[model samples]
Target chain A: MNIGIVGLGLIGGSLGLELYTHRQQTQAQISNNPSASPSPSYRILGISLEQKICDIAVKRGVVDEASVDLSLMSQADIIFICTPIAAIAPTVAKLIPYLQPHTILTDVGSVKKPIVENCSALWPNFVGGHPMAGNTQTGINAAQHHLFVNKPYVITPTANTPLESIKIVESIVDLLQAKIYHCQPEEHDRAVAWISHLPVIVSGSLIASLRQEDNPDVALLAHYFASSGFRDTSRVGGGNPELGLMMAKYNRDALLRSLQSYRQTLDKITTYIEQEDWQTLEKQLHQNHSDRLKFNL
Target chain B: MNIGIVGLGLIGGSLGLELYTHRQQTQAQISNNPSASPSPSYRILGISLEQKICDIAVKRGVVDEASVDLSLMSQADIIFICTPIAAIAPTVAKLIPYLQPHTILTDVGSVKKPIVENCSALWPNFVGGHPMAGNTQTGINAAQHHLFVNKPYVITPTANTPLESIKIVESIVDLLQAKIYHCQPEEHDRAVAWISHLPVIVSGSLIASLRQEDNPDVALLAHYFASSGFRDTSRVGGGNPELGLMMAKYNRDALLRSLQSYRQTLDKITTYIEQEDWQTLEKQLHQNHSDRLKFNL
Candidate 1:
């Protein structure tokens, strides 16, 4: 089997590393069973727009082969599109000419519906995936084989999606020891809007609102007092700007719904404060505290 | 010199531990210089309404002595009102009968203005102190001596406040190895509205909005999908409910202003997304990314 990875950024690079690691383990098993289902036959080929990134990826053992050309993916049984959301569809479109008859294309997009719609429209075997992992860090340099371990990896499958394609994604996630989840493309988009996409917008608004104060003294002192709470709340807002923008761009409607829900909650709290309704406000805040405890985050 | 710590919770208990450690260091210094400022002379007296908490604090050596009676604080030269914000003024009023002529009163309230107003009206030597440390964990069991080390410790002094009273609080902050910052009570309130108080409301709203979805399946799955981003963004929202409420109650006006500013930013981002203005939205997101980087948070 041959696996092709497009865009050697964090997801692609990490996937390459995990796949390579899995390949070695499978190779050890091949000594016992030459043609077992876990046969060590898969080759990881990475694709990138930057020749430099490709060379570095190969040196880092993220891939057996890498190229700037989409044609490099033609020999693979499966191809994972790990590009940014804005580039996923276009990258998939460029690879359409090279897609083999049995090629199964998938993606590690945070948003699902639009990417699924675009890619599945172009190719029938596309499965939309989202590995609910990663820190604010990005790029090839930050990638590691351990990223997906024990993390939830959701695969959004349209009715037109083949079972075999979904299982292929499951197999990779299984190799990385990630939890598997299956949901409809639209459902995945809506759910992540509240949890993932919505957080980006909410957190971004916080940073955008915090300006260097009119008084320089106050501004300097504000940073001194920002503390751990501010650091955690503002983390996602400081994530890859392009990636955050793309999530908002692709998952606009659901994210808008999430914003509305968030606004409604904020309005209620704000009105309680504005009215000096401390009892009700305290009650609401208590609910929030308990609500968060339920998640144990 | 003797120190009184009121309301033996996180701040009070931690201060007790720290003061005890400082007392030991001063004891060591006593051997070197019998008449120096570090004369090993200070004793820590802790006051709490709960007998169990008081008993446990003494047993844990958080204080040299602990008592439920307000009279226990009468012997101390300085008193730190470490009670919840909602209780600070009332606690101060109750402590007034016990305050000595030279007693210097300070507080570890997150919102300084209201507490300062009430306390200063009751006591002449009151200095508003806010040690910007502590996790969500509460009670004496969670307290440690090192909680305030190298952290920001703000002292908000009113025009009516005596320089001697401010220095007394500064000395304790210095003993804890914390960096001391002085500001007007109002300025401290406003600055923290952006960095501290506002984040509680922002984070709380995130959790309050994330409910058991209308669809139970969606609700359960949403938890599975709520990743590190959700955890970080919702952290402060899950903070001590009573503490967060008091911040909102005491610093209501400044926090309201922060909410308005945050809403305006959110409105702008929402408009861009609603209007499908990708270029503007992307630009705004880029600014957010850079804005947060400036804080290094």
Candidate 2:
């Protein structure tokens, strides 16, 4: 079975490595156990805009074969588009002519609604996917085979999405040993806006606000005194600027709604502080603490 | 030298362990090298409101002696008031009568202005200290001898503060192998408001906002989708409720000013999004990312 992966950075490169390792492990298991059914051999074909990244992917054995041409992906039984959120739609549009009718296609973009709407129209087999993994680190150099292990791999499917396409994606999820979640494209977008995209804006604005401090001495001391809490809180705000912008661009409406709701919460807490209502403030903080604990992830 | 530590929680408990370790190390070094000058023997006396915590501190050997009696702290040459922000002034007031005239007093509270103002008038030798360390974990169980190692230990001194008091605190900083930073009381409060206190409110409000989601389905899905980014961003927000409230209480004016600046930044970002000004939004995000990187801590 041929599996193709495009944009071989962290997500794509790591997926390629995991797929290759899974294939090797399955082949070994079949040889050792005669009772086990023989599985088809897997071949990973990787495509990247950068030749250096493609060469590194090949050198690191992330992919059995690497290419700069999109047409080479036509031979794969399945393909995973792991491009940046901004590029996902355009990349999928560019690859539509090369995608075989029988080949199931998917993506690992954070935002789902727009990508699913754009790509699913061109390719009926397209399934919107988002693997809830990865650190702040990016690039092919940061990719590792175990990146998706035990991570939530959400697949957003429309009513028209074929069951066979989902099955194909599920097979890959199984191979990666990742947990699977199913949701509508809109639900995925809204959920991500609150959990993923919202944090970026919240965190980014935090650091940006400090930069607005009028006092130079306070501003300089703030940089020195930022401890573990401040670092953790502002972490995603320091992430790749282009990526942060794209999430905001593609998931604008839902993210905007989240921002409004978040503003209300901030105002409520501020009022409590202004009024010196420590009881209400403490209660609100305690509730937030409980709510955070509920997210075991 | 006798050292007293009050409120044996994360900062106090950890300080006790570090001080004890440093004393032992110094003793061992002096024994090994005859040419080395002998340092004075150290004694750590820990006091806590909770008897169990005091017992734990003694059992763990974090303190040479532990007591629930606040008056017992009078015997020490120096006292480290490691109480919560709200209790620091009150705790010092209660211990003033027990303190010797020559005894130096300090605190490890996050906020310094109110603490310094409230206690410095009563005790001539009082020096406001804030050890920039600690995780989300609290209590005696979280104490570790190395907690202060390589961490910033900021001392806020007013013009009236004695040079002798600063030198005494410097000796402790050296013993803990931590870096020492000196700033004014107001400077420390303003700086912490931007870096430390502001992040707590920012993070807590992020979690608090998610709780306002009307749709239970979306809320449930958000809980499932909260990834590493959300976890990191909301970390301080989910910390001890009383601690969060006290920071807001003591650093009210500065924190409110920070909140105002932060709200402006958020409004600016939201306007950029509303206007679909991707270029400006991207630039702002890029600038924020650069600013966050500048904080080496």
Candidate 3:
């Protein structure tokens, strides 16, 4: 089976490596166990604007073929558009003309609603997906085969999405050894707005507020005293500016809703501090502590 | 030389181990190199509310002796009151009756102004200290040597603080191989309010907002989808509630100032989002990213 991956960065490159590893493992298993049925072969075709990255992906055996042409994706049985959130729609539009009717389409974008809407309108084969796994690091250099292992792979399929396409995407998720979660595009966006996008704002504002510190000495000392807590909380906020902007742009309304909800909670905490209500504040923190444990992810 | 440590939890227990290791290293050096002057023989006395923890500290070789008696600290040349912020003042008050005039006192509390004020009033030899090294884990079981290695150890001394007391604390910091930063008590509180206390509020509110989610499905999905970003950002918020409460209480004014600053920055980011000013939002995030890099902690 021919698989096409667009935009060979962290998500794309990691997916390519995972697919290649799965194919090799399956081949090994089939040879080792004669009773096992032969698994279909996989050929990964990587498409990227950076020809240099494409060359590296091919050299690293992450992809069987590398190309700058979207037309090459026409031969693929399935295509994963791993572009930035803002670029997903345009990339889908560009690839639609070149894709076969039977070709299965998906994405690894953080926000799913807009991408799902645009792709569902253009191609019935598209199933919106988001692999809930990433690091502070980016680019092909940060990519690894185990990136998606044991991670949550969310599939957001609308009523218009075909069952066959959803199943194809599920099979790919199985190969990646990721736990699959099915939800609507709206649900996926809202959930991500709370868990993913909201944190970027919270963390970004934290460091940005430090920048606003009028006392240079205090600001300097803050930098010196900033430890694991500050580093961890501000990790996502200090991520790629373009990516942060894209998440804000693509999921603006949902993110705004999250911010509003977040503001209310923050205000509540501030009020508790202002009123010297340590009991209520401690109770609230305890509840949040218990709730955070429920996430376990 | 005798060293006393109160509250044998993460900070205190680790300090015990570090002191023990340093003494052993110095003894080894004295034996190997006759040219070097012999260092004073050392003893570590650990005190805790839990007798089991005290026993464990002794068994683990974290301290030379463990005692439930506060009077045992009278034999110490220096004492590190590594208690909670709320307990620091009272602990110092209780220990003051049993402390020797020459026993230099210090603390590992997160907040400093209140501790500095209370301790300096009761004990002329007290030097306010906060070691910026901790994990999400707490208690003696989580304690390990080298916790303070290369970590920031801030000494907040007021005008009334004795120079000899500061030097005593500096030698201990040097033994731990931790970097020391000197500031006033007010400055330390403000710096910590920004770097430490504010992050707890930001992270706790984030998880709390998710609990307020009207849609159970979205909330449930959020649990599955909460990635490393959400985990990292919310880590400190889910920490010990009593600890968070203490930080909020003792450092209330500084924390309130930090909250006001944080709210303003969050409001600005919200305005940029509301106005669809992606360029400005991206620029702010870019600046934060660069500023975060400067910390390198």
Q: Which run of 10 residues does model 2 chain B get worst, by summed lDDT?
A: B34-43
Instruction: Please provide, for model 1 over A1-297, each residue's C-alpha lDDT reduced to its tens digit, 9 standing for 90 to 100.
Output: 899999888888999999998888788888788877756678999999999999999999899999998889889999989987788899888998998898999999888888889888999899899887776577789889789888888888988999988887788778888889988888888888888888888888888887725666766777878878889998888788788877888889889988988988888889999999989988888898888777735
Q: Write the residue-wise lDDT of candidate 2 on B202-243 in tens digits.
A: 999899888878878888889887878899999999988887
Q: Lowest-scoring 10 consecutive residues by lDDT in candidate 3 chain A?
A: A34-43
Record all residue pairs in model 2 with backbone atoms less than 3 Å apart, i.e. clashing.
none
Q: Whose TM-score is greatest here? A: 1
TM-score of predicted chain B versus true chain B for each candidate: 0.91, 0.92, 0.93
Please give the ranking of all candidate structures by TM-score, highest first, separated by commas.
Answer: 1, 2, 3
Q: Can you list the residue pairs that collide in candidate 3?
A: none
- Candidate lDDT (C-alpha), each: 0.86, 0.89, 0.89
What would the per-residue lDDT of candidate 3 be over residues B120-173, giving only the tens digit for each residue? Answer: 898878899989888778899899888998988999888878898789889878
Any runs in candidate 2 off by more than 4 Å, and if so which? Answer: A41-46, A49-66, A135-143, B1-10, B13-35, B41-77, B136-143
TM-score of chain A of each: 0.91, 0.93, 0.93
lDDT of 3 by residue, A252-282 (tens): 9899999999999999999999999888998
